[model samples]
Target: QPALCPKGHYCPNGTRFATQFGCPEGTLSNGVGLQDASECELCPLGHYCTGVGIHGAPRGPCSAGYYCLRGATTRTPNDNVTGGICPAGHYCPAGTSEPIDCPNGTFSAATGATDVAACQACVAGRACPTTGRTAPGAPCSAGFYSPLGSA
Candidate 1:
């Protein structure tokens, strides 16, 4: 009486006239059959999985100005590597890893800058009047003046 036993239940060998069978322990028997369970897999690069048994869920990637470390399981928001973004009042040159302060008289109009060229300099005939001054239209010193008022 093989039909007497439910699917996934184990039946002893040579029991053609079996009337009872026991389900295996430590295994799932959903009335289908015995099968192995799938294991969790690591997320691919640029993607992160936060939970177990994640079959198909959207993953987050490192945003601009940020980098993911090797074997990273979680990412910090707005976190950056040692050479990620240019420091305040500094510029990160093309293809370089660190930020550099703009020259004495130069000033960066924006933060997180990438190049020295973006730094605006005091126009000719106008003076910075002081060190680390950022405003471009700073009036000229006593000895200098913008005759043309060009900026």
Candidate 2:
């Protein structure tokens, strides 16, 4: 007798065993007897699916300091995880699928900053020369002055 395959798994016709094939990574199945790979749904947005045989849910949410789009296979893509590091001059809040650029007149020195608050305002007398500045750039080029938050 043939039985329905379990969630996260698929059994093709003439299959001898239900677990003969597990759904590939980046996808999940919530119901039993998934017959084809297409039955496995892509991991939902803001989530990552890193493990094999994921049945009821994705491996987990994309970790902090990172973002995951739909079907993300890892937490952060920059050697540490999967979805790709929040680039310089940008911040990524929790569950963010994309990095948000720091507003003008602000800058971030770090790459994994998690919030807009991480983008520091240009200090008094210093000019943030660019959109994504690691440090308040050259000191107003001597003589010329800038107020706080100057870009």
Candidate 3:
């Protein structure tokens, strides 16, 4: 008889069945009956909604070195939680959603790096130019030499 609540599941208010409730993790609910649960939606930027209900789709992306951000429930983000990894100098390749600096010249103290050859160059005397440089820069001020990779 009473229909509705379908999209990702959600009923409430005298709800008889209809999946009772699902949309949880980062959120989704494409819309159907959705009674409460904030209506569900988030889980966008970078993606990672591992609620196992919404179905709206999103349990992907945010892998490589790591980045995510938005509602990322868990795709890699570590240290504590909520989009992390790929720090030092930045790199994040694969599904990387963000953090991709390390450009001008080249530098990377190392963290998650996934692309750009892990940014290295610029070392001879140190220069780096600047972009996300984790190191290499406070050494070419004597007579300005810079040779190795410079930048």
Candidate 4:
């Protein structure tokens, strides 16, 4: 006899009811009828599996512009617990494990940016602002001119 295995549980070929193995805190099971413990899959970056013996279909995807680290199984929306924001000075697309720094002449002023559009270009006449997360830095002081992206 076979039963439905939840996302956080591992059901072997002959697993009994409720006796299934736990997928641990950082892993999960996406489907049912798992024949081996190997079926337990790692929760990819930007994704989570909070409950036990659950399915990935309902609780997956760590939200756009946010990266979910490996072995992570919980929703951490800007809370910095289960997950974290994209952060300033960088752009983070959906389902990313890390953020990419804004290239020279470009800057990002907000967190959780889903695309490069979040990065703004520095004015050619103004000195690049030393500030992070904010693009288009303040204009150079009187008489102090600067080329594009000048720091």
Candidate 5:
């Protein structure tokens, strides 16, 4: 008696055929019939898929220090990971995985920096006056007024 083909395998007019069957869409055949279709798997945390088909081959993993920017499928050979770069004036301590902001008194003139130099002591006549203040506009402390007033 003729029977319906399996979900993934091929059937001719209600006749189930085991061999020469095509794999279901979005899946790849690793052998024959429904049992031959290989389930698609997600790329590893540090890796991404660039193309289709899974025949015992693993997708490439992102390089050390680099992170995946967007969600990608398929297996490809060009995927890579990049290290975190800090901005100017900012310091990303060694072994630190994420970017950190420069201290309160420090400033970053650029992006992806790693280290921040102590803010230049407020100019000779000018003083920071406060702990979190930087830049040349900071006012002088009490009893230590700037001779130039608002220079």
Candidate 6:
């Protein structure tokens, strides 16, 4: 006979409190006949959850190009994709899911740069050349003299 499995818990077989266990800290699920904790999926990045999930449904995902933390829910939900932005003078290449800084010779003033190509080279005359890491802030700020590799 089928056991009386409760919501927010899983019943692999004929069992009760002796076998049922709460969902792990990073996962959630619902329904009956659940076999293992693996049925509870980890909350995706850029999202959060407050209480245990009613069903095996994701709370949400962060917007494109923006990063969101884990386990976000109604109280801690994201209003926009402004969780964080790839700072200027850095790049977030499409190849990887993480953000990276631009090389010394190159710099970028744009936000959410999703590729190394967004990094702009410090120009001559208008701006000093960049060396590495320390990219020019607005083309050397006029008076600050910079050689070919100013970054």
Q: Candidate 6 — which residues are off by over 4 angstroms? A: 1-64, 72-82, 93-97, 125-151
Candidate 3 RMSD to the correct structure: 8.4
TM-score of 1: 0.34
Best by TM-score: 2
Q: Is candidate 2 or candidate 3 better by TM-score?
A: 2
Alpha carbon lDDT at 111, candidate 5: 46
The local distance difference test score of each candidate is 0.41, 0.79, 0.79, 0.67, 0.38, 0.51
Look at candidate 1 and tell me the lDDT of residue 12: 49
- Candidate 3, clashing residue pairs? none
RMSD of each: 15.5, 3.3, 8.4, 5.2, 11.3, 7.6
* Ranking 4 against 5 by TM-score, winner: 4
Model 1 pairs whose backbones collide? none
Q: Candidate 4 versus the native: TM-score?
A: 0.60
Q: Residue-wise lDDT of candidate 5 within 45-140, one digit each (tens)? A: 334444344333334543322333222332221232323343344444433333444444333355433344533334555643433232544556
After TM-score superposition, the amount by which residue 31's alpha carbon in candidate 6 deviates from its true location, in angstroms, is 12
True lDDT of residue 20, candidate 3? 68
How far out, in Å, is residue 52 in model 5? Answer: 10
- TM-score for candidate 3, please give it: 0.43
Candidate 6 local lDDT, 1-151, one digit each (tens):
4555554555555456623565554455655656666676555565444455345655555433444444434323234432355556655432222356677766676776666677776655444344324345464555666555345
Deviation (Å) of 119 in candidate 3: 12
Off by over 4 Å in 5: 1-85, 93-97, 116-137, 141-151
Q: What would the TM-scores of all predictions be?
A: 0.34, 0.74, 0.43, 0.60, 0.28, 0.42
Tell me how far the alpha carbon of residue 120 in candidate 1 is from the true structure, in angstroms, after superposition: 1.8
